[model samples]
Target: MPFIEDFNNNHPTFIKNLLKKSPGLTQREVLLCMYLKFNYSNREICELMNISNSTVDSYRHRARKKMKLKRTDSIFSYLNQL
Candidate 1:
């Protein structure tokens, strides 16, 4: 996917470390995390991914769980740290 290529090109190290840290994450989840890292809102992600708002929420929740994030943790912060 173009978005994947773009992200990979722009943030190669972050992507590598993220995959190493959470190997179980699906491609979609990784993509979601990238978007969150860039501070994309749910509605923006929905439009960009051609998915519904609820689907975006689900992806966020699942990605958070896979990343072992606490409930109070910010996904943006977690991704940025990675």
Candidate 2:
């Protein structure tokens, strides 16, 4: 996964540290959140993860819920702040 390599290239331990703190997020959700943090679109994420569009949306929804974000807040925006 080149994007995973890209993510690691930039953030290093950020994702790893976050995963340690976020017990509610599953592995897929954590990876989705990391991709979202990097400002990748859902379509791109779907392609990278080899999942469907709806599946990407579902992961985003679940990740946002786990993070307790408001519906109006952008998940990527919130993630970037962290």
Report the lDDT tens digits of candidate 2 across residue range 1-82.
7877888889887676666656689989989888778778888989888999999989888887887889898776666766
List all candidate RMSDs to the true structure.
1.3, 1.8
Q: Report the CA-based lDDT of candidate 2 relative to the real structure.
A: 0.81
Question: Candidate 2: misplaced stretches above 4 Å?
Answer: none
lDDT of 1 by residue, 1-82 (tens): 7977898888889878998988989888888888888898999999998999999999988888888899998888889887
| TM-score between candidate 1 and the true structure | 0.89
Leading candidate by TM-score: 1
Task: Give the alpha-carbon lDDT of every model.
Answer: 0.87, 0.81
Model 1: residue 21 alpha-carbon error in angstroms: 1.0
| Model 1 ranges off by over 4 Å | none
